[model samples]
Target: MKLLHTADWHIGRRLHGFDLTDEQGNAFEQIEAIAKKEQVDGIIIAGDLYDRRLPAESSVAMVNQMLQRLNLTDHFPVYAISGNHDSATRLATGTPWFKQTDLFLHTALSQAFKPVELADTQIFLCPYFEPFDAQQYFDDDSLQHLDQAFARVVDEMKKAFDPSKKHLLAAHFFAAGSSTTDSETNLTVGGLAAVPTDLLADFDYVALGHLHGKNALHMRQARYSGSPVKFSLSEAAQEKGVWIVDTDQTPVKLTFKTLTPIHDVKLLTDSFDHLIHSTDDPAIDHDDYFGITLTDTQPIPNVMARLREVFPKIVTLSRQDGFSTQVRYQGESGQQIRQKAPMTLLKDFYEQVAKEPLTPQQEKWAKTTLKQASEGGQPS
Candidate 1:
């Protein structure tokens, strides 16, 4: 059986406070093209079909349009699940009605263990979950997490499975092998969620998600398809793509379907005078988005306008002049301190950010003011 594996659509997500619906639309167009080019027998999206529990009306329309385009007319069966960001009930509501078109949407745990069989392939879908869901599922009321929850779910699935057949698992969770960045939002709170690679031992192939960068989980038996679009600047060089799985009723082999988006994100740093007029450098792609930083002792005049001419998609520009920065020592509040004493803790905080010590007079003034605020008396 041949399948095109994709997930983490994250529809209606915002980047730098700008709506990404149009970019997302473009991504779907690429997906359709790939699906057509590959002529795969089926498509399986593991999870995270949307960015929010309650998506905007426009996002709903966008998802509907994309799904309709993929399965309705194309005649390929699409089996998907809901992730931590989705509204399970909302996503599963019209699922029965939509099943007529070869699109299988599974959001509830009751329906999760059921395998979707197609052409000698049995795919087990598991969505993202919190500690509570597992706690409720097992009725244990303890700190059940990713490892435990997945173990429980997969164990149940194993009980009813025909081990002789090729079993593929589709999931969304943070794998321990993957690296994280400052921009990544915590998928599971309290550090209770994380699954082991070995937990899915019985499955022939595991298509995974959640981490945005592509990775080889235990030599590609388990893997992350990665996000279709670059979510943060940290993921600047990610080769965003989907996975193509071909199962031979014994083992599955994966092929990374490469996707090249129109815009490339570049980070450039130079002195404003040289950079702004550096036409001699390789011609910048007018369509690429750039994050350029100007580093100079003196501020450059008309910097943004000049660079915008060269890089049409320059969204962010920063100046790294020394004076462009600020060093402020924050006290408790505006009325909290006037001056600090050598023995004062509040005064100690004031010295940290500024990297300077408070003078004697300032300390005395602060002590007097603090004393006055402490009592009903004025600064003495």
Candidate 2:
């Protein structure tokens, strides 16, 4: 079976505050063209179909129009799952109605084991799940970690696995050894929220989402067909695209086909003098998105307005001074701050900000207020 693997569409996503609807719409058009050109058997979108839970009506319409054209009109089957960003309940609301069409929208834990068979390949959809949810679902209190939860789910899936047919797992997860960028929300706090890659060894192809790079996992068979467009300044250099999989080969054949963005994400650095002079450069596309790093030590007035003349979609502007060259007074300063009492620090901060020490009466009031606050608003 020939499949076009893509994920993390994040339809309503914006860069800074600028809307990416036009860019995203163009990308979808390209995707449709690619699908038609390739004439693939089906399309698999792993997760993060939208950027938010309650997407704007415009966003809803945009996605609906795109899906309608692809699944209903074009007559190509599309299988998708909800990511961390999506509200699963909302995505699966039209489950019954969607069933009549070529679109398969899987959301809940109950949907994981069922395979959507296409030709010789059986695609298993495993949407994002919290550890607590898995713990409750499996009736196992020991499912405290992500790996444990995945192990349990995959184990259950194995029992019903058809060894005769080629199996593919479509999942949204932070797999071990995958490289991540700033745009992705942390899947877990403090503790690592990653599942072992070997856990997915049973499948011929493991199509994944969550981390936002096509080559995030660095594994051949198990791959992430990253976010189609750049979502953050950190992802400016990332070559955005989808993956084409040919499951007929011994080791399934994989190809990375690049998708051109309407507004390319880029970072440009130059002094005020150089930028103003290069306003009419034909080589530069003013409409493309940008993050400008100004080399000037002093702030220039109307810099953004002037730059917008040459680069209209500048999202962020920062100075090199914001980044420190070395650790300055780290241990001693930290130790001093820790050694000082809370009340003393507060008094010192007040003095610094006020430019005067508190009067005796004011000091007494401050102490009393601090004591009351420490005692949870009770007199101490």
Candidate 3:
């Protein structure tokens, strides 16, 4: 009754237009290795198998290969569901045929509420569904909100509940009190969107997903395993991995297992010059994708291009300079402005109006242009 609980695979996801298939493939390798080492009986991917509704052909191939390795080659039963990011109809394709080999995939509400029984354990798979769709599927017109729909589903499961066996709920929904990251799609319908954790308290163990932060929500035996890889800059520091649950224990023994990635997301802050001049560290993987913040007061020309020479995998660049501060307008006499250098006057004016001082390179160019104007020459 041991199971490897993982979620938010987000396969074929891109970071700053860079393809992450190789990184995701590396993650899958880690998953396979962990499954072997942990010797878990089965696997449960709560939801979000793909990054989008329709994934690329390569992504499809990648998923096919990984599933085959787990279910066919390694002979482990895999139970998966479709998250909000997945296309239910698309994911459900060939699911009937796949189940012939112990690979069970659930998508829409019509398929939910049915328990997949495994050796004295009953696994209830609850896929993501819109409240309206769920209402129609259950033929319950009173289901006006997401919570109400889920409550009805849970009530149905209770009707057929067997007290002697272990009941596990694999769900793809955000529970109240879960920490959310920017990468997740916000269901901003107020109270209609989130479901209370107490509603799912009946199950022995609840394998939940949707929110990207690992340990996002806390309940007795319910937790989100989080995305296997960092999906956004907000998730840069999160420890990405899977959760292992042993049903053999009276209360399931849950263990968090970490997975290593090929190109991990990293955030670095320093002056652009230092980052460009810093030598590559052999011990550290400099090739990791980075979100860099330049602390220089003056902007550097061709900063991205120059930094790429040293840090080729920079994905995001931001300027954290004092020049970005809003300038207060202290009235100065026009006579006093005329006494100052044109470049200095221009820089002050620009900073006041634009809320950002001119870069050193721009100041130099402005000085040259003013000198050309004073000399009666064309300014470039």
Question: In terms of lDDT, which candidate is strongest?
Answer: 3
lDDT of 2 by residue, 1-380 (tens): 88888999998998999988888888788888888889988889998998999999988888888888988899988888899888898888777687677688899987888888766878888888888989888899999989999999999888777877888989998888887888999663334699999998888999999888776787768999989889999999989888889999958999888889977998888776887787678766768888889876544558788878777788898765532212222434767888998878877666644557988998898889888988889764
lDDT of 1 by residue, 212-295 (tens): 766635545777787787766777767888988878634578888877766766677777777767766766665567777778
**Residue 338 local lDDT, model 3:** 81
What TM-scores do the predictions have?
0.79, 0.82, 0.87
Off by over 4 Å in 2: 188-191, 321-380
Clashing pairs in 3: none
Highest TM-score model number: 3
Q: Give stretches of model 3 more than 4 Å off.
A: 188-190, 280-284, 324-380
Task: Provide the global lDDT of candidate 3 against the true structure.
Answer: 0.84
Ranking by lDDT: 3, 2, 1
Global lDDT of each candidate: 0.74, 0.84, 0.84
Give candidate 1 misplaced runs (Cα > 4 Å): 188-191, 216-218, 278-283, 301-306, 318-380
